[model samples]
Target: MNITSTLVTCVDNWLQNLYTKMYSHHTETYENTVEVHVQETSSPLTKTLVLRILINEEHKQVHIPNIFIPLNFHRQGIGFGLIKEILKVANVYRYELFIVDMTPSFYDRLLNRNAQPAGYDAVRIDTTTRL
Candidate 1:
């Protein structure tokens, strides 16, 4: 018996609620889905923007890859809040996810920054906060 399927379904619904508020102007697709992608460049040299998807742990739930906020933007804390919001909700239901994947440039962007080194991977920055 896995509540994960149900859990993700619920999370997706809640996210859509917020997605509508934040991106109300931009029409969405793939019904009941809100995705986030973390890319490095604004308009990449290539047609595709490689985004890094990081999850802390997972029960193997389904999620759309649509949160496309560049890492540069995340460094400034834009879509980061949304990610945290979703992570907090997921944690509320007790679902843990881990870093899925990212491009080399994604790592390079952070390294290029003059800011103090958080680590080999700043993705370690946790989003799930307790109430």
Candidate 2:
């Protein structure tokens, strides 16, 4: 993978439009919603979105509701890169990170990889785990 060509950006109006077009069924919105997108610059004229994560920053907490990476792009470190970027943001803001509705194994893998920034941890909340 060409890491130099990969770009991580926060959501804006243009991104919101693209996200809505891609995920029409996810209609719920939050006031503090933050989207982080991982795009690969395949060519000078084309940028492909390989991964996207929706996080809600509220009450000094960061809640990740969803993470999407195309099947073809899995295991390519795109998702990990996106999470690292989000971790940087969370570290700066000192927000407690929570992964909601995602498989616990994923969080475990991240933890095993030492992905969490210093003084910050990712909490997994789902049916199988309690707060």
Candidate 3:
């Protein structure tokens, strides 16, 4: 998913968890979620950042459960790049449903970063339905 020189890859483990504690104020991990790892070509493993995206094939939807970029990696477009990758996968698999479980601040940031207008408003709670 490297749209540029920076290395963007998928990680199967928490080897970069140390960077989370050192660079973020929140230390909580998003358990049982798939992760997309980002890092510079010259950077070490500990310098990588984790972006979590949960895909539910039964619902044919994609979810952004967590987006955590290290403080040192902020303002470098890493977050946007990560989301771009997610969108690409969704488009390829014909999955248009998206859910962002994030704070207002991060939601605003996401909307400003190439997100389609009113996409969030398309979500419904399904109060009358029971599965």
Candidate 4:
């Protein structure tokens, strides 16, 4: 929860290690990892997230797991905007899209054609009931 941008490269590497361990430990290829992204928060570090992903050539979008923000940080639109910005950037590199199977505002209508629910991926954008 660094209330700032989490380097995608760092996240990718961390996830790789996490996935490998989980697969080997359980004798299965299912697992998740904790992810932290820095954004503007009231304090220093805020909430955190856990993510999981399974790559498929048909899709190209990465999965974002549960995203959360501290109660204080939830007041501002930073969390929502942060998620929007993340999606905007990551969605581009995809030729098709391998987004986690979930519902998002952008995926609601306009971008639905370009994005699809991910079956083996996950991420959540933290938002409080206040927002």
Q: lDDT of each prediction vs. the true structure? A: 0.38, 0.44, 0.46, 0.36
Per-candidate total of colliding backbone pairs? 14, 0, 0, 19
Highest lDDT against the true fold, candidate = 3
**Residue range 14-83, candidate 1, lDDT tens digits:** 3453344342222222343333322223443422222223232334332323345433333545444454
Q: lDDT value for candidate 4?
A: 0.36
Q: Which portions of model 3 show Cα errors greater than 4 Å?
A: 1-32, 36-49, 97-99, 113-131
Query: What would the per-residue lDDT of candidate 3 be over residues 1-131, giving only the tens digit for each residue?
Result: 32111112322223344334353322222432455554543446554436555556567666666667767657776555555555555665666534366676655654554354335432211112110
RMSD of 4: 12.1
Error of 3 at 30 (Å): 12
Error of 4 at 119 (Å): 8.8
Off by over 4 Å in 2: 1-30, 35-58, 114-131
Task: Let me know the TM-score candidate 4 reaches against the reference structure.
Answer: 0.37
| Candidate 2, run of 10 with poorest lDDT | 1-10
Where is model 1 more than 4 Å wrong at Cα? 1-33, 36-66, 70-76, 107-131
Clash total of candidate 1: 14
